[model samples]
Target: MIKVLIVDDDFPVRMFLNKIIDWNKHGYELVGEAIDGREALEKIEKFKPHIVITDISMPSMNGIELIKNIREKKYGCKTIVLSCYDDFAYVKEALKHGANEYCLKNQLNDKILLKTLKETKNLIEKERVENGQYESMKDLANKCLKTLRQQFFREIINGSWKEKKDIREKIKELKLGDDLKNKIIMILEIDGFHKLKFGPHMRNRQILYNSIMNISKEILNDFNDGYVYRVTDKQFLILYSVHGEKSQLNMYKGMKEFAVRVQKNIQIYLNINMSIGISEPIYSLDRIDEYFNQCKMSLKSKFYMGDHKIILYKDIVKEISTDPIKISNREEKELIFYLRNCQYEKINYYIDLYVTGFKERNVKIEYVHNFFRRIILIINKVADEYDINPKDIYGEDTNPFRVIENMETIFDLIIWIKRNIEIVTGKLRPNDQNKFEHEVICEVIRYINCNYMKDITLVKVAEHVHMNMSYLSHLFKQQTKNNFVDYLKDVRIEKAKELMETHNKKISEIAELVGIRDRRYFSKLFKEKVGKSPAQYKKTIG
Candidate 1:
């Protein structure tokens, strides 16, 4: 079949082009459509169309430029420009750039289009024969057919083809099946696929994806009653026929068995884990989108059910309840108090209680998600109160919300939360209180040393350390045997003495360098501490 691509910015124009011709009936396949020349180039690379039907003007790139790029890159495709009477200049330019034909948009008809396509087809055939590339071209066309097949199923699952007749015609044209009404949909998803895509372990994402696809195809081929389509980077959709099953229950059992085999094979061969979501049998072809959604919803149960398991839509309905997880005001206070005091034992108790409640009530998955997010936020709120960054407890790169969203199971969440809680409370536990206070004092001194040349104040320092000003003042005096102001004054005086000894400068300059704005105040303070005025001290040092 001759492959054709349509590129136009106007939605109605593209739609008209798409529907005006019975492409498959007339030795052509409408491989894909794009709204602009840039996207058209991408489709050309992927679909490798033999001819391009494009508007003369487009956003990002125009038809003339697109044709130039095709020729420059040796894509060897013929172009037909769609233009209006006012676009004569653009049409002339496009033809000069090797556009095979020009069609006036207002006068476009199927007969005219068919004639243009035939001429384009002849040009393509002549080129292929002269270049002796028939076998290679044949291979590329077959690959395009496979891509078209996947696109066909993806569109149906996404509800892109809303009309039943269009779907039926495409399915038959693709030779997928004559009857798909009695089918089951299963979504097989790779666990932690994002990690693998970006993770150091699987550096080549395409290779990993292709290997998974091959494994899926090999396994499904053994069953001989199912077909698989790549849904996303991490997911594959399986459409299985229940033709031989005597009952729905039998079909479900067969699905479970198939899923287990797939998981085992992937784990053994690729060293990767997978999860499956199985939907109930569909008796109508029109509800493929609804059934596909059922599979996706079932897959979400894996957030609590863990990975490497098959979740049945029927099973989830039996297991879940609609109740929202709740916390009373008193309960909230209790949690806050425990967090403030670093009472880890109590925190553990609460964690266990929440997990137990979730399991016993069989709470909805969304409620669980909400509960997890709320708990993390509460933890963050407490951390902020202590001037502690949550990143220090978790890793700097960790995003609590994203972690919660992607966590595979309740157990995974519990482990992460408990581990972070231990870190937070361990730093503030009473047994380590003296050490923690000493560290705080050291940090405060370092802060003073660094900022003594600025407007240093107890309030600013306290805020920097995330401590109460009074408490920080008391602790500073107790630990260093000097109050906050005395320590800050001493640091400035020492800096001033160093400057006076090292560089020849005025007393005012020296005072200002040490963050003392008034030279008289600096002299008085220096006399009291160093037993000499600024000029007298500088003379003695000289």
Candidate 2:
């Protein structure tokens, strides 16, 4: 219920007004009352009422003075003035002081008072509804802009915006002007986006999206009449009108400086590399799709030119070379040889060369996936020849298989494979004939180490290892002579003990670095595993 504060110099006037009006029926309640304007001010502070009904003539302060003070303080309260005289001067003073209505003492009755109260409530409710609608519209606009940005980014990354009608509709919805006179499309792509991997539960995707959106908003705030939208997961489209027929080179210089500011302010590890596609301002939105394609092609130029830079499509026209980098029979043999011999570094080196070559030659990453699948088939045949378990060699549990699904870059896949291969081979003692079992243990250990921040269960470990959940549970116990969950806790405790030896870092930082995201969970695990909380352990060490 809306709260009302009744104030008047006369006690009888206050009591009679209170009894005459049905405050509840009028959607209000007399939460407090005062004899004079000064007492009313005190009660206003105490009750924080939404409406104030007061007499204009009072001691120490008048109704007009009280309303003036409230307005000066920016208090959101409605006021109605009461006076014995129906004088125009009193009404004028009250209105000037932000009183919503004026009333004469002799004219006051339940009918007039209730009508005024209901009217005030309706006005307040109307303003609230209008504000809420504005908020909803703003939210919807933001969401639509985000979706368009994602679609645009995907097209740029995928090398073409095939959906022309959809692009045109988005541009129209954003109210982006068709007087593309001096308009340019710049694609700001974050370098090494594929290298930054977050586990599924980390919600890293949303974090990255929010970061890009916030950074884009900050950068675009300088443009008086331009829209900046995320064109993709890692790219943003900046649509701005170039002021006063600036030279293309001058515009490029300005864009580069803006990108540098974004990098400095955002603090993301990757530098912003932009590919600018300048369109001869066309009068039609249909032409935007063509320019969008050109902007996308500019991003592909980064594959030919190395990192930490910008590429302009106009500048690279003559040098735009496209030569297909076919996976020759000999190259395939060499790649397999590196994988089989466990030369992981060489594997990654070749993968980078392969991906770069493909980008330069206009070969899509999906096509490269097909090539890799074919190579994997050949590798399986070789595994069969050597009588090695194909499942263990190219196992679904292995990082190579998982990386193929998650990682966009060949380098990422090679790195995962290399690390797993090292764990399989380097950590095994001589005469350990059960190499596959040893590899599974190493994978489990790696999972435990990587996920110490989460509640690591045996089922989760087994799922990662791609074994029957229960069968792996029994196998893990037999192999380690301890339950899988216990082993994981022991591993976390051991890491925590090492962290306690360091005097500088906080216990929380150590907990996070060791894979425990929650400080409380880390402390609990520390207590469970080491018979003491993390703080206690630190104190004991100190």
Candidate 3:
């Protein structure tokens, strides 16, 4: 409808104009009234009325001034001047300033008013067409239509539209077909799209988005009945028509097949994989929001199922385990113990267990946010114990929680947490400790050399240097390019070879002398290190 705003200083005149005509019946809407030219400009900007009616002489800016101001601002609305019999000069001035026509207040009637409005409307449309703005106006109308459709879709998905009458009216007004009543809602997410946003393709993000959106549209067009809405940068919501299908089984199968084509085409054409989550077909439009949630929840299965697969809502529902997922106090304590002790292997193992438990239990992505907080809290506790500030590991500019929030999968979350834990725990010792890294490794080596004849373990050597067993183990490997245990074995094997050359002792005696009580185990180690069993080497030496 063409919006109309009336501007007049007279209150009764404004009221009469509002009450005189059935605006909607005449394809016009009297949106608002303004006291003078100043107020009219504000209303024009706010309502964007297509036609503005104003009286000639008024305070705080006259109709002639208003017309000139409207022309100066380039407001596209047509203006009509209202004047008294004696105000022809003012009306002429108004016309000179861009007023399209004038009506005498004394001669004003519904017929004349309607006639003037119609002529003004025709003139405006004709001018727009002549200036090549007709198509632009149509585009604007279409844009508005699209916005309404998107809003309605959001309302249905959010379950906010309650009145069936309103829903039907919107459905008719928006021209969304009756087929939408029985539809499947599918949410498509570009796999690892979030990572790409700040990665190598960050500059061409719009191109990537346009490519994905275009591919989705082309593939859906092939299916003959679906609409796609970009819900976010990395996610699109699709409404597919399942209007004629009789069998629920067939409907889902068709939806799945369509989903597969979309997934495959996007991957093939764009070299980008996307995961689709298809909602169960719903017969009622109002139930759309519920199924839309199902689609989103289904997509979370990617944490376990990985990307590029079509996840059906039905499959997820059937497999939904009511068993709650959380790290038990005992499990949390165990993880903390491993972290505090700088047990890198144990820390890595427990992180995997926690993350894997999430996948195994089919935990919702929401729960994982809390799980991230829990793990970070546990790590921070160890950081506190060591007086190591978390910022030292996480960095002042980075938010660890935000990083976890952006993670695409639980596995990614675990990898991130494990890395941060390693950094934090590796810093548990004083700053000066790093200065003595070589000394620490040499001391460890000297201890092993002196004690090669006795039983030696990583724990025993860690006690000798009063360093963390895990850190010392890591340092030993970093310094000597071999692990402590392997180094100890090498030391013992070398001493045993010396004994073999200097003495005529049996293999078992030599093994016992080097702290390898298991003679067979010694022989295995000796053969591995020396490329021969002890007796074979002894005979060769002889």
CA RMSD of all predictions: 23.6, 12.3, 20.1
Residue lDDT tens for model 1, 133-182: 87788889878877898787677656688777876677778775644667
Q: Which of 2 and 3 is ahead in TM-score?
A: 3
Residue 74 alpha-carbon offset, candidate 1, angstroms: 38
**Candidate of highest lDDT:** 1
The order by descending TM-score is 1, 3, 2
Model 3 residue-pair collision total: 0
Model with the higher lDDT, candidate 2 or 3: 3
Off by over 4 Å in 1: 1-142, 152-182, 197-203, 245-253, 318-320, 433-542
- Give the range of the ten consecutive residues with the poorest summed lDDT in model 3: 427-436
Error of 1 at 183 (Å): 3.8
Q: What does candidate 2's lDDT look like per residue over 463-524, in tens digits? A: 88888888887877887788886777687677668656732356765776566778888788
Pairs clashing within candidate 2:
149-230, 149-231, 153-231, 453-515, 453-516
lDDT agreement with native, every candidate? 0.80, 0.66, 0.79
Provide TM-scores for the models: 0.52, 0.48, 0.52
Over 377-435, each residue of candidate 3 has an lDDT whose tens digit, in order, gives 89888888878767766767788888877877665565456557756655553332454
